[model samples]
Target: MLPRNTVDTTVLPPGERFGMWLDLVARTSAPLRVESAHAADFAARADFTDLGAIQLVEYRYPSLDATRTRKLIRQSDPELYVLALTTSGIGTSSQDGRRSEILAGEFTFYDASRPHDVCHHANEPGRTRATSIITLIPHAALPLPPKRMAALYGGRMSGSEGLGALLAQFLIQVTGHPEQYHAVDAGRLGTVGLDLATTLLGRNLVAEDAVPTEVRRRALVTQVQAYVHRHLGDVTLAPRTVADAHHISLRTLHRLFEAENTTVAAYIRDLRLARCRRDLADPALRAQPVQVIAARWGFGDKAHFSRAFRAAYGMSPQACRDGAAVTARDVNDLASRVNSARAD
Candidate 1:
């Protein structure tokens, strides 16, 4: 799991919330001049998770003015563009002389390398506080000219619809389960994020062609992979079924998989085999039988599944289930049968 930096104002005395938060944020993200409504009313908490190139910070706090100054930029390392998603709060931000009020389910992109100010206050004094998630994206991820890209900054993108909704869902997954993803997964996630953001901004700029072709292809391929992974337990998940579900032809689906150095059938089979191998190693699954595990991953024929398993893993299913060691995060088929059998 991804480690996080968490700060709760309730831990310290009410008077220390302002200073302590400043210190914590300075270490977790870009250094800034922070001002709360008043010294005594400052009550807040923040959780920050650093994902490879991106950072996800969740906050619930009273109104405050957070200023990104030139001096802070010179002092900080690896400056970024902060994309703020306000989920349950009201916020107004200003950058490059642009200002906008962000409501619930809205996002604002502000450059940490430039002078900017985010002023948020509880509309009802001590009765309310703005809550938001800040995703820090690198400048390199966005591939548009400054003037063109400036339109996305300090404005609200409806997080409730279209590509914005998809991106919001992705952000939630990354922040909610960072540990479930690996290094390569992180890079893929980051790439998809850039592609989606670029696509969103490009549409608004009336320059859809500005997005990189490879990036778009990767995004589509990632979507296909996710579909296949989610339906792995379905014995009917074939290439044709996949293509039809995606509204693409079988040939096109094969073409997409070709770029990944594998075919659609091979990909699904490999994933299932890996899962079976993992379950074979699970001591908790020791009482399970071999044939059940094979079928669980959509292997219809016991002999066929055994031969395939041995060819890929150099062992029979029974041997693997006996004492072999394997590493896998996902399992299917036989494990389901095992559970069913135990329940019966």
Candidate 2:
């Protein structure tokens, strides 16, 4: 789980709100700036938070002047990936040595790590309504190469098709039903985000091969692994069962695992043993018997589980559990020292 903090500044003076926004960008490392035609009445509102591996920012800009906006972007050099969807008004943006005019019903993406500028001009008074959803994710999280992503920057990618369309729709849904998402759902959303962004950006660059076969294979494997881990307690967790859940034939499923050099049963056993090892190390679980923890991770036979755990971690399950408790204490002690030092 990750901490979530929200700041809504529609109530503040435009100048004060802008200042507060600058402070937020500084703290979050999201380099962005805004200017309004009626600097006094113009409102800027943002909902920003970190969801585990991804940072999400949703913003609305109302009635802004184009020239003043140019100055703001020149100043904030935050190196991050940004996706901006315009819900209303007309604007023009330039980044990565490319410039494009943005109209209503259009969405554009750019890289903020480099310098970029966007100018918004409303058609009439109180007419501008632009909403943008920006994400700050680690470069490594994207399966595609940076050069491929750069090619797609400042260009209009199809958010109206396949996974991109679904993602765009999902974002709209989340905005409408923010309450529907819980802490756990945010992580899942982040994963979907990775897939959507990567897929769209890849389509834009014509770099379909940028995504390696193994990486795609691993992604599927990870999904299956997570599903198996979650349902390990069920007695019927087996290869055929996993295939059915994913809507793939057993032959296709076997082909997917071929690159991993392991069968589905072996993979499940390995993951179950790994989870058991982790549980055993937890001091909170120390009171529980080794057999109980083994059963929890779906090890029906205690002796077999013990042998596997020992082979994997080079220690008996009980010794590993005891060692984990000691390690947890050391970690807690170090954390306390760091906190004390910061306080000083």
User: Candidate 2 lDDT, tens digit per residue, 99-184?
Assistant: 88876555577766665678765564655556656666666677778775777667665456544555566556555466767766
Off by over 4 Å in 1: 1-11, 23-43, 47-52, 62-79, 87-106, 112-131, 158-166, 178-196, 203-206, 286-296, 299-304, 324-344
Root-mean-square deviation (CA) per prediction: 7.8, 10.4
Clashing pairs in 2: 79-113, 80-113
lDDT tens per residue, model 1, 1-344: 55677788878888887888878768755788887776585788788776566667888887788888888888884757788877776768888888999787777888788888888766644557778888887877677666677776677777877566767777777776777876557655666776666666666667767767776666667767777888887788899999998888999899888889999999999999998898888878778787787777788788888899999988888877654433232345567778999999
lDDT of 1: 0.77
How many residue pairs clash in all the candidates, one count each?
A: 7, 2
Clash-forming residue pairs, model 1: 1-179, 63-121, 292-334, 293-334, 296-333, 296-334, 297-333
Report lDDT (CA) for all predictions.
0.77, 0.68
Name the lDDT value of residue 22 in candidate 1: 79
The most accurate candidate by TM-score is 1
Instruction: Give the CA lDDT, 0 to 100, for residue 119 in model 2.
Output: 76
